[model samples]
Target: MNLNLPFSDNLPTNKLSASFANTSATYKFYWLIAIIEIVEKGQVNIKKREIFSRMISNSWYTVNYFHVSFGKQDLIQNAVEDILKFESLTKDIKKENLLSILENSKKIETKKLLEHFNLNVPHWFLSPWFPKLKDENNSNYKKRIYSYSQNFENCCLYGLYDENIIVNPIWIPYLKSNSKILKDFCYWNLSLFLQSRNPNVPDIPNKLIKPAIRNGLTKQTNEYWKNVFKELGYVECIFTGTKLLFEEKNFAIDHFIPHAFVSHDLIWNLIPIERSKNFSKSDNLPIFEKHFEKFYDLQKVAFEINKHHNSKSRYMDEYLSIFPNIDSFEKEKFSNTIQPLITIASNNGFLYMNE
Candidate 1:
């Protein structure tokens, strides 16, 4: 997962590599991403607060929705959680809307949160280029970095000011010309960093951004459940207890644990619920104590019926991965499998419906 930053005789390419070395928190990665994004937009004179806003916005979904751990040392995650609580925002807020809100926020607490990054992130991000400043104890240590940045011979990434950072004129062309490569490098490193912290989490790379579009469940999955309904004559929605009619297609298939949490549509996690209930249940965990038994019973009946009619059906294969033997599948085994996911999803801030 090397960065492979474009070689430049004029710029200190080695320092760019060193910038990402021995990182403790996720701030540097997100900070660099914010810089690259701003640079791409044809703006070199950027506000430090704007970079901070982009850092929070970029990691919003990773922390809030996917629940990716940015590790305990990371304050960015704390800032994100605080803003969400302070602003009373939904986890799924759009990036543009979230950024706009962050930029325009007047709350004193919100301003303080973004300002905290200025203490270390802006000065420390350029530490690799100015290693001498690492041990300096001067009250005006930031001023020294600012002085160095103004000298093009030093080739620092950006010139820091009291309120903003101006991209070094010498390095602007390099950043803009190689924007895509530089972005991929940052994300590649970020994915590796997150994977180490969240070893059990799946699809770490895809979780980095709020997906622009999520693919719908396959037709085969829908057809498989339709067969289950047809054989049973009717099925009750676990969430609302409404009887669903297959003849009228009066049901929608959904995840017992939210698809946003599981990030998959495997048949084992899928169940038919009242079509109308689906909208209300979007991305929320169903209270396990209230819904698990009914969900288990419905799944068992569906499995038994499906196994009898089409034992080799591809839809049944998903259950085999967890259940191992379809004939031996028991409620206890199913509970062992599903209960932790429910708990973890809840811990990750997926609210329970009606809670």
Candidate 2:
């Protein structure tokens, strides 16, 4: 008998949050969570991945919840057709395991799958469409599928919004002056911003993403902005709503002005925010949604303004138009605006940088 636990509350610690369902590990992890919940709640008859596979096979043909009832078949089938029609070598391969049959498994294959999907659909939509995945070593079969779906979905979203309409400007004097601070700033900013998407206490040093910051002038300005936020102490993320105590790292570098819509990357625009909340704002507008009742004190003022300005002043709509969503822009902006947000940085002993 399946234990009737509340859906969200029943989630396992090891699984990915609903927000991270687009990622492969998270997708598999979510099912893992469900399986664990069944065991923890005292159901001895639960079959594992095999049962999941059976569920997919049984559910695949049902049009009612095909996207959620089946797993990867719907989207992956399109990819399979593209491969069979285009790739000369794939013609001889059987249609059953086209994903596994493909060569150059990682980059080339993944990119091809992404291109075939052509964006627009959320990767999570595939959760019910695929078979229960087994643990495979060399191929990382599941992750590749998830990444492919996410990439395509993102591309579609960006294409529709014209999110990448403008490129970063070629110049910024502050980034040139403070490369060291800027580098550290960008590293931590991206790291913390990514935390909510992987809340299982991320193994620190997860190989930070390097923004294409090459010029000396641009590097300096980036540092100055980070320095300012560093001086202000700590601020909470407006989205994920996670607050780091003084014992924890209370501060992060955020972009005051995002580089996507605004051409410049400078330190003068960086700011500090709490880590968890940063995730809630993922590349979208940062204003609190109606659901954020807990942040009433912080949100009451901004929410009203967003309504008044048509979501322009202090609202993230302008930048979000070209990014993932308002929430997505908030996360990216929290990650990108490390240089200018410093102006709002507060000074207190709670935040201390070891010299």
Cα lDDT of candidate 2 equals: 0.32
lDDT digits (tens) for residues 73-100 of candidate 1: 7989999999999999998999999999
lDDT score for residue 185 of model 2 = 41
lDDT of 2 by residue, 1-355 (tens): 1212122332231222233334432123222323333333444333332223222222222111111111234553344334444544322333224333442234564445644332423233333333244344324644544544334332211111111111111212222333344334433433443344323322322322212342333333233323322433433544345553434655454443322222343332333456544343322323223322333333333333333444443334434433454433243344343322221121100121111
Sliding window of 10 residues with minimal summed lDDT for model 2: 158-167
Question: In model 1, which range of ten residues has the least summed lDDT?
Answer: 217-226
Off by over 4 Å in 1: 1-6, 218-221, 307-313, 325-333
TM-score of each: 0.89, 0.20
RMSD of each: 2.6, 24.3
Which lDDT value does model 2 have at 204? 25
In model 1, the clashing pairs are none
